[model samples]
Target: MSVPETPSTSRYEISENPEGGITLNIHGNMGAANAGQMIDELTALLSDYSPSSLTVDLEKVDYLDDFGTLVLAHLRKLVTNGGNGFYVINSSDKIKELLSILHFDSLDEKMSIEKKRSSGIFIRIGEATLQHISDLKYAISFIGSIILSLVHICLHPRSLRTDDTIRYMQRVGVDGLPIVALISFLMGLIMAFMSSVQLEQFGANIYVASLVSLAMTRELGPIMTAIIVAGRSGSAFAAEIGTMKISEEVDALFTMGFNPVMFLVVPKLVAAAVMVPILTLFSDLFAIMGGLVVGVFMLDLTAGAYMSQTIKTLELFDVFWGVLKGGVFGVLITWIGCFRGFQVRGGAASVGQATTSAVVSSIFLIIMCDSVFSVILRYWG
Candidate 1:
């Protein structure tokens, strides 16, 4: 093949081959004379295509001195700084040898990149998991303290902080009513509507009331309310407690001989235990009411008939089961929230992260616990 010789010594011919990207078939020795010139020319070539990546082939080149190395490194930096990608292929033996010496060989470089990326992901996930478990552990410890305090209070009823506990009850229970009402009512309405649509086709539309009431009262109402509370109150409690923890207020409480569990945690737990059942009752009532509305509108069934059907299908066990589930959910929400709060030991961001983790972790545990309860009851019954 005839060599296509160019007039300009500084600038080299660049053929964009579809088979390979940026094939730079080097002819002569790459040195000081060629280096600066190539850099200027290559810089211009880069401004045009702006490819996702650039591949510089050195297979045709007979030799590459140190100056050539400088140019290649500079090119790489340029592409990266311009927010474009870069790659190298068809390295000559000399280039490969130099790369090996400089610790930039392809095999090692690729392996290093992979290791860094994988380790980063693994580290992030591991950190999240550890943090969650740590928060859970703190929550369990707090509960243990609360249990001890409760035993103490039981023994010395006169020393009980009745007034503070009462106030906590008001906050956790009464204040949470509106949100619980709306969500539970909506869930019931949705269940009723969907059930009525299908059951009406089978001429079983009257059964919609039973379906809505039984499902909500037995399973959905308490679980949904608990999950919501975990999201709302659990996070708030964590943040509040976390802030106090990071600020060393918890230490101060200990120094002053006041039990942090009694001062902060027990109130929330007791309040939640009481409030959850109340909310569950409200949820069951709202859901039934919602089903009743659907009955009147869609099924043309009288409220009396719908209520009668619901009563016939509903069992006392179902009501007790729902309340029991709500109690478990309540314990979970309070435990998770208080635990997350006590686990806080950093800045505001840490508190925020702990709060979010508490909510997510609490919800997961509640569902799992509820599922376990259901399975056991089914087998027991």
Candidate 2:
């Protein structure tokens, strides 16, 4: 079988061999100019022809280049893919040298691509277990490092980054104030309106103020403020540190004999711990004002009556307890945020994952800690 010759390129003549295989005899130049056309014609001809073995006879009077080598590689792949043997023979020393330089034999090995198989459920579970264990170990270490950093800061107050702390305070507390106040006020209004509906039936409408004030001061105020801060400031801390981590800035800090935790984490921690409690106080105030609005308008109670009831119901201990919870939640948020940031690996995608993880972990910790506090407070009372 003869392939129709193209002008100024190689052509192939396939001849039956004594071994019941086939020999492809090529003639003319086999360079880039002819490579594309040569491969197409060869592929079309060989599509219908399969043999036990195929031999490429390249003894033709011509030159060969990388593109020509690629054509031969393609033919080898086609034959081998059909579970047939492919061989190259009768090349000049120059052609042989070029083939050797290109490591043409490696092409056959490369042609067989290996596919990855998915692991079984047990294997996946085991991998996840190991990963979690590693993460937990890292978390413990990070916590210890943070404690040490705090101690160092206590010893050398001058080392604290006052400017960064103040900036974070503005970001975490002041910037967050409007939204926190709005949410708290709405929460209080809803609570008062709902409670008044039940209390009005029994002539106990004034007790609505007591419910709003006590709930806001003792529970809702600190928890709600912490959640808002987690969504805003916690994610910001993670993203900032994650970016720095991926950019090698964290490593640079270590190389310069600076503790990354002290330099980066401590300021944010201080800012959050100080400001979140203050924010909680504001949240409680707004929530009471919202309740007062509901009481005066909906319940037909005077502002003085509402305020007097609220003050009578809330104790100094209740306010202090909420502020203390706020401070604890702030520390948890900053810790988790910075921890997730330090855990980031790879690139921009890892930073995004870290940011998301930080917010979720912070919120979970906040709720868990709040539950523990509830148990403690219940028993203490």
Candidate 3:
């Protein structure tokens, strides 16, 4: 049987061979313009006749492009998939070279794609352990660098970046004041109101001022301030240094005979250490005022009596302890932030990850340190 050409740019004649296989004689251009229609028509013919084998004669074809190569590949795949032989013949040297270049011979073979197997649990555990060890080594090295930098600055006071330290102080302290104040005030108000509910039942409403003052001066003040600073300044420190790290600015500093740690980290560390305690002191004061507001209005206590109770309840040691904790938390925050920044690799995405890690690590360390302090205080008191 002979098949006539359709409106497609490519034409092909299918004839049943005497040997019981079908021969496809292709004519005209076998380029992208007719590749789709050619594949569809050829596929339908092959399916209808269910030929035992297919022989594609490319001798009459005028031109063949990559898309045409695809049409040939498609037919080869279909025939082979149906357990029949697919053969290409009667090609000019040009067509033969084109097919060879396109690796048309390999088109009939199935591709082997190896899928990766999941690692065993023990292998994952080993990897995690090694990663933690590597991180610990880096942490120790960074801490040592920080200490050496501090000593160098101490020995040569003028070597310190006084201007940068001042700038960071303003950024960490002054800029953070409003939010710190608002949060501390609200915290104090809530504490006072809650304590008043219980104390009022026992006619101990006056103790609300004492409870608010003691908590703010000893515990809540430093912890709350540190958390806020971690979220704001800690993330900023990581992002700033991480960007510098990825841009090779840190390397540039090292090449210029500058200690990257001293140049970049020291100023931030000093600023945070100096300013955080001051911020905590302010936090305590604002919280006291919030409690006073609650005491005077809700508890119907005179402002003078509330102030007296607060003053009488709080010792100077309590204020000093909170400030001390704030200073420690400040150092931890800046150190972790700068360390995470230095750990950054690759591009902008790494910087964002570093910033997030810095905040989370700082907060975790702060709470952990606070717990230790609580244990020590319990024993000491």
Quote model 1's TM-score.
0.65
Which ten residues in a row are the worst by lDDT in model 3?
1-10
What C-alpha lDDT values do all the predictions have?
Answer: 0.78, 0.92, 0.92
Better of 2 and 3 by TM-score: 3
TM-scores of all predicted structures: 0.65, 0.75, 0.80
Candidate 3 collision pairs: none
Residue-level lDDT of model 3, residues 112-224, one tens digit each, is 67689889999999999999999999999999999999999999999999999999999999999999999999999999999999999999989999999999988999999
User: Would you list the clashing residue pairs of candidate 1?
Assistant: none
* Model 1 regions more than 4 Å off: 1-140
Summarize candidate 1's per-residue lDDT along 227-285 as a digit string, tens digits.
87787778878888899999899999989998888878877777788888888889898
Give per-candidate clash totals. 0, 0, 0
Once fitted onto the true fold, the runs of candidate 2 whose alpha carbons sit more than 4 angstroms away are 1-109, 112-127
Instruction: Please write out the lDDT profile of model 2 over residues 1-381, one tens digit for every residue.
Output: 122244476678999887768899999878767888999999998877777788999998377888789989999888887788889999999889989999999866775668898899999999999999999999999999999999998999999999999999999999999999999999999999899989999999999999999999889999999999999999999999999998999999999999999999999999999999999999999999999999999899999999998889989999999999999999999999999999999999999999999999999999999999999999997
